[model samples]
Target: MTQLIDPFARAISYLRVSVTDRCDFRCTYCMSENMTFLPKADLLSLEELDRLCTTFIRMGVQKLRITGGEPLVRKGILTFFEAMSRHLGTGALKELTLTTNGSQLTKFAEPLAALGIKRINVSLDTLDPAKFAQITRWGRLPQVLDGIAAAKAAGLRVKINAVALKGFNEDELFSLTDWCAANDHDLTFIEVMPMGDDMGSATRLDQYWPLKDLRARLAERFALTDLTEQTGGPARYVRLAETGQKIGFITPLTHNFCESCNRVRLTCTGELYMCLGQEDMADLRAPLRANPEDAGLEQAIRAAIARKPKGHDFDYSRQKVAGKIGGQMTRHMSHTGG
Candidate 1:
């Protein structure tokens, strides 16, 4: 039987699953000082995750990324990976990746890599251990670094994701570039997303780390070169002066690339978010289980895909980053797998 596709003609090939909405670290930009997390029962169970992943695979979703406040923090994560890997072979998943803060990576890296998990991106804002503490209130930088080392030791493709907040970690750009070059790690500088505001964790524009200035400064130290479009995900790539070090920049604010966006996020509660910045989501747990028929379930998935917006418009000119939407503390990044 022929399958139905989304309005964009994209078969929703990628899926980012949020395992839970709970986190140990309280990063100033992602979580609130007093965050109220969801109950454990609300999160998708191991069986649920496996079932949903299989269903998504059947619908042409080939790549899967596990996200969370920190996916490693989720109990039975290694086992979950084992089950999913068994059900969905490594080749079946073009890329089965995970986004984490790397706090608990040391413990899970080897096991996860053994489970056929190939690539990993760890969120690290600063290299200085002290500043790392300040950025992630309760996190230990050593542990995170160890996690990175473990992933590398396990023979997995490792990448470091640093959210460049203007005044916060912007000063460390040079250090970060040098670090990535020295350690042979792909470092990506991400602009703080406006989605943080919806969760009541917005930062001012002044805090935004602009790529224009960063690129200029790096030019003095290294001869930067651009990469081809086929290189993959949004981050525009560049090489170091003499060495073969690769660095990337995710400049969503300065240069929004939503037109070529091919991402779909699955919230921890089983709601599918087609667009990162938009508020349109469709619940699949109920409909999928209510009617087990393939066509019936496929129709529901298509309906959600049809609702996907073309792009997101986050006003950068607004002074008050958290203007009217101040109750975003409700769902943590762990909940939506950001």
Candidate 2:
């Protein structure tokens, strides 16, 4: 049996594939309001994505995650889900999940659940309707609320990812946990990391709120216990000491757990990024267009993994410098399959 293992001996079994570089919301942390989206022609076709998944599955990838600027908005996504549902039934894929903004989730939840997609991660920062609109620029909180409920009704395990920005929504930590506990969903607090070509946002780095301090602050109200049950993602889980509500922390800046990194990201443009925090990437599009054969694409994947950086090189401890786009944090989280 074949397995994806980097030189560091980490077995890579998960793959995140971005289907589009377009989003409906102008998330303050994800992209600017004046964002220019990638041309429709640049995106990989549904067939190309399906082919890539087949090759990775053959290589022993156990899990597949569908991500995008907003995956559901991408055309022909339902068709892709239909294809993956077939794989799920046959056990060709061990697990299938998605990370979405929950914009169109209400409409797709039942169909997705029927397809055997058991889990989903939704990006939601604030529970306050006004704050939600403020953070997302023009997001309607009611829509997301309804979508989340629809997902729950469809029996899909839901996880929430909230970026712990200092001034933004830091105070809502406990409130978010309370909501998660009530909903029986897991919540992950991710430290805001510098990503993308927009090095111009100086105060964005100031929003970086380390998990340690966050825990210390939140612990005053809630006790947390370490949880080790696998959900097939990088975040470390800790159940709220009292409510048994799970809370995860993805701290790439303060403390990066890169040694256990076991995943690769494929952008919508068909580039395989070996490390999320690093710029080490392979142009799968050029090779796929030229060769389109399984063996050729498989070789391309293996070659890219061969040179996958040992770990990401991000330094957030230093003073926040304006307009400095260096290190592995050069790509936008939207394009990087976050």
Candidate 1 yields a Cα-based lDDT of 0.75
Q: Candidate 2's C-alpha lDDT?
A: 0.83
Residue 50 of model 1 has an lDDT of 75
Query: lDDT values of the candidates?
Result: 0.75, 0.83
Error of 1 at 307 (Å): 1.3
lDDT of 2 by residue, 1-338 (tens): 57878888888788999988888888877777888888888888998888888778888787899998899999889999887767777787888889999989889999999888998999999998988998899789999989999999999999999988888788788788889999998899888777765533567766778888998887888877888776666688887779978789888877768877889999988999998877779988887888756777778888998888877877665434654445536557788768
CA RMSD of each candidate after superposition: 2.7, 1.6
Backbone clash numbers for all candidates listed:
3, 3
User: Pick by TM-score: which candidate is best?
Assistant: 2
Check candidate 2 and list the clashing pairs.
196-331, 223-241, 277-328
| Residue pairs clashing, model 1 | 69-334, 166-207, 199-328
- Which residue ranges in model 2 land beyond 4 Å of their true spot? 323-328
lDDT for each residue of candidate 1 in 219-287, tens digit (9 for 90 to 100): 887888997654335688887757788888888767877766666888777899887767678997776
